[model samples]
Target: MQRYFVAPEQFRGGAVTITGEDAHHALRVMRMKPGDKIIVSDGESRTVLASVTELIPQAMKADILEKLPQDSEPAWSVSIAQGLPKGDKMELVIQKGTEIGAAEFLPFESERIVVQYDAKKESKRLERWGKIAKEAAEQSHRHRIPAIGPVRSWKELLATIPDYDLAVFCYEREGDAAQGVGIGAALRKFREGKLLSLEEGRTPSVLIIVGPEGGFTDREAAEADAAGAVVAGLGKRILRTETAGIVGLTCVLYEAGEMGGE
Candidate 1:
């Protein structure tokens, strides 16, 4: 069945209102008609098996048949903070990152970043990134779309460390450390409840930080370590900036038992 995400207000009483692009896709692209069944999510965990009841120009209405079970979201909320890379690599990161269960994406500017920040094009870039996330979420049957945060500076990103229970900084230097904690070890510590959050009771939130093509400077890595971030090495082989976040996020989900059966 096709899945669509809408605002929570769109799901009122026992019916859902689909409008804009999604409606167009259903009405014109999918050639959906009355009585057609589809899955709809409110983008905040409320999903249902709905049957299309009415269709008109740029709009479609569906009556909720039953509430669907919630199992798509990961147990831990994992956000990816990536230093801006060149070309369209950011888009690939957002799309694949959402599919792999990244709760949010934060693109930042670091010392070694190659892409010069362009203020005029930021809005357009963010809009495109958001659309990619939404489409990826729908394709993956995710209950909620991952959020795309406004670009932040290196210092700004570091200051947000307290917001999460744990922050993992992917540093290439760790690969050469004699006693460095690997990504797996860091996640294992999280699983063991060794990492404590300022908030008393809540599902643990994690932030994985990845640098751009040039990677982070030595001083930057030192600052991140001081900001309560656990420095983790990906592996012996260094991954490209775009691939690092996806790999790190997958490691996190797999550690949390989200990849497959327990």
Candidate 2:
């Protein structure tokens, strides 16, 4: 069934009043009519099966038939702190990251990062990323849309989030060669080993940092290490700036039992 997101406040008793883009989407794009059935999520992880009861140009109303738990959310929350990539790569990151069950996304400015978003453009881009995440979440049946954070500098990235239980920083240069534990190895151990309590969640709350196209400078890596991020490698084979985040997230999710499960 097609699903749309609605705010909790819009769920007034029996009917859900949808305005803004969704209203226009229903009126023009989807061309939905009264009595049409669709799913509605409150953007708070709660979703309801709703049927269109009324449709107008500016507004639409749907009667909620039932409420159910959103099953798409991962047991553990994983947040991606990605260094700003050039062009439209961030959009791809947000879309795929949502599908992989990222809890949030952080755009960081690193020493090697070539692209920079000015304050005005940064604000606009953040808003755009949030929207993309929302649409992807709905499409993937995710309970909650991942929140996108404003761009942060390398120094600020370490300073801002200190409470995360586990932090993994992927640098193309070093893997098990330096630490004797590559990303794949760490992930294997993480999945097979009984170190973490399952109730603490499947993926384990982790902050993953992916560097820019030129990769992280040694100094920047040192800073991340100092900030409690375990530097891991995606294997000896080098990957691009955009490919690293996807690989890291996929590994985390796979280890968390979110993908390729029994």
Q: Name the 10 consecutive residues with the lowest summed lDDT in model 2.
A: 194-203
Q: Candidate 2 clash total?
A: 0
lDDT of each: 0.92, 0.81
RMSD of each: 1.9, 2.4
Q: Per-residue alpha-carbon lDDT of model 1 for 198-252, expressed as tens digits?
A: 3555667899999999998999989999999999899877899999999999998
User: What is candidate 1's TM-score against the reference?
Assistant: 0.95
Give the best candidate by lDDT: 1
TM-score computed on alpha carbons, candidate 2: 0.91
Candidate 2's residue-wise lDDT over 1-262, tens digit each? 7778878898888778888888898889999998898888887756888999888888999998888777777766788899999998999999998987889999988877788667778778888898999899878888788989888877888985566766788987776455545776666665565335556534457778898888888888788788877778888777887778878888888777778742
Which candidate gets the maximum TM-score versus the true structure? 1
